[model samples]
Target: MGFNGIRPNATRKEVLEMIAVIMRDDNDLEFKLDSMNLSLSISVVTEIFWVLNWERLSALRFFAWIRSSKCRRFDFEGAKKMLDEMRQMGCDPIVDTDNYLLSSLCRSDKTDESCQLLEEMQERNCLPNPLTFEILIYHLCRLGKFDLVHEFLDRMISNGLEPRLTTDAAFIKGYFNSLRYEEAHKYVVDSSV
Candidate 1:
């Protein structure tokens, strides 16, 4: 089947046969998809992979591909579905997975969704690493959302997850940018203490 013809549960026997053949190969699904230049949506890809019973490694590859710069056309909804599919398949996302998703969301300027996902990660005990916080904090600060920066910083501290100096600086800069010098200076002092 041609790449453009690929869709969720494609009825064409050729497409089904081709997908099975590809899955049987040693190459990764994302590689196969990209090589074919398939314009398949994520849902279609997810369904195809699910039907092929290729979730374990395929989920990782899908997340990695979605996080890559080459995947400029995908969106959060698809990514979210992919993650959900992975979790439902007993593949709980790791910190790296969370970081990849978080970074992707931030890159897309979906800061609000990123923040919510960060909280979800915490609730799921898929703790965010320094890099995750840095990405969200930096983006929030850049957008002059100092309140969110502070809230995230506090959440980080409460969770005993120390932000790096650069993240702290971003928060401080965010405060100052919003003309909250007192809060910024206090943050510097409190963090130092």
Candidate 2:
């Protein structure tokens, strides 16, 4: 990832200058990236992301950006668009990346959008790990969306993810509150096995 003599901690103006040069030469961002062998380090990507104000970047670039920086403030719609673009580009984001995005969404109280992103992950055959399930289930439980919790629990079980006891307890309580006694009992019995 030669940055064409761009040093570490490049200023925003420098990054923009680089972008201008690339865009001027190719007018195709992806093509320019491919030509430059744009496997950038996280720091460089972070600098670029900050410079671009976290606009909807390409999937690979966005991944690098996220990997390089702490995304404390997320634009949910922008992140979702980036995920969709990543899928379209056939670049399946790793579970950790998804988890980071999920956590950010949950922190912002964007539970519904988090669920939608999880569904998108499923559609792409990107299996969610236990943490993924935990984040969504916890938020759904907080929102009193027991019906969704049950569905996510079912998916978790089918995916071979053993639900943590605490998460299951919350799920059970939600189920009961939602008058889903049968489902609650089913999970209780299954867990005891």
Candidate 3:
């Protein structure tokens, strides 16, 4: 993902991560992070390495280059800065639930920050999979919150994503949690693998 006119190519894992950051979808990102070799993978993207190494004057130079460039892509410098600051303040580098603060910032209308978080996730190599959205939707349904479920299901459908069997089970469980046994049983019949 060419954030900031840098035009760097991300690895498969990196593409997965960037998507996670952009979407704020967590499940697959976390799973991939645990399996990858972060040490070697870190070197896969050079522009990002340059972004982290920038001195103030160098950063200004980068900004000038981006402004003059017509592409005007999603850049990662600001994200690198904020993430670096957070790390200095003791945030862990791994994909922690704390990262979901990006979602809250999103819900509260901090669209830019949310996007920054997603970009950062991409830089680090997190992949958000279908189960990710399913997990969120299932939890909402467990609480009998149709509005939230409706919102996520719509988002998933509109995005052309579908849930897996395990995710279908989660929805059934969620319905059972909400004491909607009839509905849960109906889902069990239609959704069981």
Assess every candidate by TM-score: 0.67, 0.55, 0.36
Ranking by lDDT: 1, 2, 3
After best superposition, candidate 2 residue 190: deviation in angstroms? 5.4
Better of 2 and 3 by lDDT: 2
Question: Cα deviation of 118 in candidate 3 (Å)?
Answer: 9.7
Candidate 1 C-alpha lDDT tens digits along 1-193: 5524433334456456546655565566556655544444545655666665644434445446654523355456766776777687675768887787777778788887898898788788887778788888988987888778778777777878889989988888888888889988898998888
The lDDT of model 2 is: 0.66
TM-score of model 2 vs. true structure: 0.55
Segments of candidate 1 deviating more than 4 angstroms = 1-33, 39-63, 66-71, 172-186
Stretches of model 3 off by over 4 angstroms after superposition: 1-128, 190-193
Model 1 quality (TM-score) = 0.67
Q: Kindly provide the TM-score of model 3 when superposed on the true structure, using C-alpha atoms.
A: 0.36
lDDT of 3 by residue, 42-74 (tens): 233233324334421223322222222211222
User: What value of lDDT does candidate 1 attain over all alpha carbons?
Assistant: 0.70
What residue pairs are clashing in model 2? none
